[model samples]
Target: MSTPGKVSLEDKFGLFTDHWSPKIVGELNGQQVKLAKISGEFVWHAHEHEDELFLVTRGTLLMRFRDGEQRIGVGEFIIVPRGVEHQPVAETGEVWMLLFEPSSTVNTGTAGGERTVTELERL
Candidate 1:
């Protein structure tokens, strides 16, 4: 069994300094909770079977879809359904976000690139 305790978001965010790299913080059921600091643009991709949830904690995130775009600000979240191609961009500045997804989900999805993280580091 795992010990129970508090997981500080600020403390977790402080452990990493890379963009687009998500560090695992906690897990529940079959899902993993991750934190990432991102700026600039991410590649367009889609998970065939996993949906991804992104909650903005720091700056603004512009989520672009094939159809349109949605602006996610602090405390706001957006879930991208499986098989939907989308991209996230932080044009103004760095953005901190919490990601919730199945443990099997990959960061880059089908659009594998240099940013694809097959193995994630825990915070």
Candidate 2:
């Protein structure tokens, strides 16, 4: 069942290590579902045009927004509506994430900081 253009999760796991970086695995409905491992604290930023949905599959994720902040563990999910600034944090170590974002959306938007525009590896 090894068909072309299909990548196993294990294969993607072996392709990354950098923190706060997202890798595009595939696309659907004009959105890209990316897999990333994040650690420490990322800048508080947002896409004024696109909303962000994050689902934690293996660890913990903290969503810090201008109004409030919340922590989610495995099996939990959070959505930061458009035009809201937010930051993500992972304490102690790493957090695995599945990001659902528009196909044209970049990792960072108008607030593009140091982590802006990181290269994505093909999985």
Q: Which candidate is the best by TM-score?
A: 1
The sequence of per-residue lDDT tens digits that candidate 1 reaches over residues 1-123 is: 999999999989998899999999999999999999999999999999999999999999999999999999999999999999999999898999999999999999999999998889998
Which ranges of candidate 2 are over 4 A from the true structure? 1-7
lDDT of every model, 2 decimals: 0.96, 0.82
User: Please, what is the TM-score per model?
Assistant: 0.96, 0.87
RMSD of each: 1.1, 2.6
Model 2 agreement with the true structure over 1-123: per-residue lDDT tens digits: 886686576578678887777888888889988888898888878787898889887778988888888999988889888888888899757898888898777777767878986566666
What shift in Å separates residue 122 of candidate 1 from its native position after superposition? 0.3
Candidate 2 minimal-lDDT segment of 10 residues: 4-13
lDDT, candidate 2, equals 0.82
Q: Give model 1's TM-score versus the native structure.
A: 0.96
Q: What does candidate 2 score in Cα RMSD to the true structure? A: 2.6
